[model samples]
Target: GEAAFAHKGGMHVNAVQKVVRSYEHIDPASIGNVRRVLMSDLAGRSNIVMKAQELGFKITSETPELKEILARIKQLEHEGYEFEAAEASLALVIRKILRHREPPFKIEGYHVSIRRDRAMTVCQASVKVKVDGVVEHTIAEGDGPVNALDQALRSALVKFYPQLKTVRLADYKVRILNSGAGTEARTRVLIESTDGKDDWGTVGVHDNIIEASLQALADSLEYRLMKK
Candidate 1:
């Protein structure tokens, strides 16, 4: 495959990706590798043919589906869902392949209201985030509704896991959660942020909005921090 990627320098990933730190100068993570998986070569899969057979995928190099799956995987990897982080993101995708049960977080309801008057723009955010199947929520006002909502939600989250301060919102994005509607359609928030040195994504929703945005914001910051 590196031969195919070789025609283009960018496909260099097909090589350094398999060798990680052994290659000089690439940030294992810049291409989406996490430190743990890189330090250990456990991420490589070569003798898994029998395992794939056990799962019932006919194991033959001549199998058109095998070639297609490999090609599709390398192609998706081009889009940035690096399966190396399979321990986290891809596990959810491979649940059927590995057969796991349940996921960690559930949302009850999250809401936020932003009001702007002559003097200032007010932001209030609130959220209901659950852990280990237990639920709790908090609401707060901020310099802007997003900040206040983040503050309020963080207040509750820290009580359960105090290590959250080590990380923060590296970036955030909100898209219309409801589509094809007019301006009134609520926006969907997709956040990309860091915890010291790690990055993650989270989502939130609401018509009132500030809290909904904050729901994803606070969760991304705190949960990622907790992970570190």
Candidate 2:
């Protein structure tokens, strides 16, 4: 007789044999359901291209632009960016590369400052952006450094890409990959953005948390525009 056991997570199983037999008829290598799990988490350009092709996206592994896109992903990852968690951003990048689309805006520089005055803390950010050879500088204040930076960046870019006004940051996350390195440890930043219709995630990595956040934020905006 098969004995039933209650699992820790409110799950119940009659026996391991039943579970094993259930999947026994399925080929491990050819299992469609587990294909995503079987894929490498640190997928490269080839993997991206393969995934895209599976979805009917017109791109070939042999394309020269594919190599360039992979190179760019590698360079960013070397600086601490992780794309596995932000596949949408990766897809946008591949699309832009394939279409040879121009970036909507170029960032020249940015400055963020946080100050505390007894009872109040203030955060400010200033950003410089170039669009069609014209440069714009804007400043904004927010509750935190990141928020301030986002506001400042948008203020500078809104005139050039008004579509940006429709986009909003839906979520943000940060993780330290190597806490043993303490303040110098690599930090990964993930940002989720939506423009009423679609949502996407972007990732960045850097020793500086703010820089990582900025990279993810920038990619999020770029992805939105490229998709549009």
Candidate 3:
């Protein structure tokens, strides 16, 4: 959903258009796609084939070479393994099953806030960081709870690894699993992040929506650290 603007200094709008056109003539105004690129090896290939087919390309999923891969994918998906959650990760699982990487960072704590007028829909953020046995904390505000929480986490990580500096919150969605009458509700958040190298998705759920955001934010970096 829509969140606050932290660093909108780049041509993200143009980049989005390029990707949209790369796929097909999609009307962004109608779709509300803030970012246009899809980032994943598996999604890349699948998207290409799907786009071609959707744009009237004649092809069959039953190609002798694709049958097994397709079936396996469907099997895993039916079993609850969602590649759509992390495309690079799905492909990596096959190759990296032999060896896993080490984690680079650990989170300890964080805080976020939102005020009037600035009462961001995504109003929360906090980060606890550890590097080389040393610890630090960084917090930032966002348009929503999850966005702010992730921004805080990434801000901390980027200080240690410059590569993380470019990562951006691509999309966020929240679903209420239990009604709160008004003030309290158990919510689930799905967060999507992009940094050009890869894209990933993480989920968080908790009674306090802000805490739920923290849970997902923690998983996001944990996943990234594992890759590193």
Candidate 4:
């Protein structure tokens, strides 16, 4: 038999390991709370709804609006959006759907161009966004295509939503889901943003890197605006 010993006051003591028979002695409410805490760590639309309700938001898994949100989540996941890594963005989607809130802006179109010259490589982005039926077009240059696109989009949006100026991208990640497809492989992009007070993550998936990045970036901005 294996035994453990503890020394106290120059005396050796043997410690015995005991096993409990069952959880029957535990309070049912306490067990339920433990279960809930475990389930919340796993990401899913139902979990999102549960968390929303816990925060005093009136929503349910079976609600039509929740169903719509789930459908959208499924569609995006199928396209390569990984909500598990971007729960903050998913929460925002749930809030917007439950409240029937309109998006602050709509993207009309965007263009990203890369040029390589003898001097240096340049990336430029131009975006068209519609706010309150008025469309604003803006252009900007960045160290890379994604940076340029982000700058251009934010420039177009800051006029209507000044809060966006305080928001900045803190990190960005990209994962190729199907490398076997070569250049046509689907890609997932995760973007983390912070407003100096709070932080959040957003995700997107697409065959084109720019498209995926744009989707994530848009979600991050929308989430911040909604929270504000």
Candidate 5:
């Protein structure tokens, strides 16, 4: 069903945009599906224009922000950030350019520690986040470092944005960008989040796995908050 109307390659997508029958055999709406043009490093400006329109923003070839958004996408892709499957991150980029809105919260500092005994292991995290100039310090314990960090971060922010209680991490994926670097290789994290009513994907890339995860995690909650 997905293969029926999902277009990715730049040329194919451009053609489909010009004429749907150029590549599609049936109208997507016939099956209650809509044509999707996936965004990636291979995307053209038309892809950005269409995607922004779908997100409730009008971005034409003449729009100054269109060029900046395209350049930003290309630059991020070069840094090991993939947007084809991370529309939530891509939407944030568009919003940053179009609206110039400030983020709801800022992370001031965070620390994670692991304790091991002969019988078991425990991971604890402490997070300091600033919301509207007031700092919230939170601590949490989880099964692993990432889990602990997630808990601590959310606990710190939830008080300011109560709507975040409904948001949860649905899935997580990690990819090493430079395998040859082995232990020092950069990592890219992709996070899927859902707030019961909607699901979205966000991505982050960094040399440190924990930092990468935090980047993706922060985007997930920020995206949810932006919706409100």
Candidate 6:
């Protein structure tokens, strides 16, 4: 029902941002929904302004940072990041632009090792992170390198942010940006996470699948922490 009010194209989003009734026929709130302005390569300054406002930032087309944010969004989209389906990551980008959000923890380093045999394969990940000036290191094994990395990072962080214990990945998807590049193609990882109450999606892009997955996983957890 609310999907009817979802605006995507650069021009449409800009118009809707300026005057909601211009594109939307009815008041979205009347139906217990909101007009969503999706961010994409086609997004304009209006889309960025609407997004910032949705994230609780007072911004406008006149804001100087709006140009920088739009440029950064386009650059990242060119690099294979898709923000339309990853509003959580987009919100984080705005938070980064405002320099108002501080990470709950900082990853010091991480290492993932995989072993393959005729019988089976094993993946182990070791992660080190710092929270409030204290360091925590943990090792965990999982079904895959990405899973192992997520487990290891969560294990290291759960000590300080117990809320993370409830967060789990609901879905994971990876897309090769340039199939012609074959194995050398850049990858975009999209992760859907939930804490049994709310769900959010985050995106990452990199030439290394693992690195891209890590970026999305970090954004997923960071987005959850931002709620608190």
State which candidate has the highest TM-score: 5
Error of 5 at 3 (Å): 3.0
The TM-score ranking, best first, is 5, 6, 4, 2, 3, 1
- TM-scores of the candidates are 0.48, 0.75, 0.50, 0.76, 0.95, 0.91
- Compared with the true structure, model 5 gives a TM-score of 0.95
lDDT of each: 0.50, 0.72, 0.55, 0.74, 0.90, 0.89
Higher lDDT: candidate 1 or 6? Answer: 6
The 10-residue segment with the lowest total lDDT in model 2:
1-10
lDDT score of residue 122 within candidate 3: 44
- Model 3 quality (TM-score): 0.50
| Model 6 worst lDDT window (10 residues) | 95-104
Ranking by lDDT: 5, 6, 4, 2, 3, 1
lDDT of 1 by residue, 1-228 (tens): 222211112223334445644443555456654322220122223212322443344554354344444444444444322332222222232332343334444556667677887898878767787868789888888776666666766766676667765556656666664567777776656565565666766555566456556556655653454344
Candidate 2 lDDT over 33-66, as tens digits, reads 3323111325455465655664346876577787
Q: Name the candidate that leads on lDDT.
A: 5
> Candidate 6, which segments miss by more than 4 Å at Cα?
1-3, 29-33
How many clashes in candidate 6? Answer: 0
Candidate 6 has a TM-score of 0.91
Off-target runs (Cα >4 Å) in candidate 5 are none
Clashing pairs in 3: 4-143, 110-127, 111-125, 111-126, 112-125, 121-144, 122-143, 122-144, 122-145, 123-144
Could you give candidate 3's per-residue lDDT for residues 69-133 as a string of tens digits? 44554554443344445443333333232234334666766677766665425476667889889
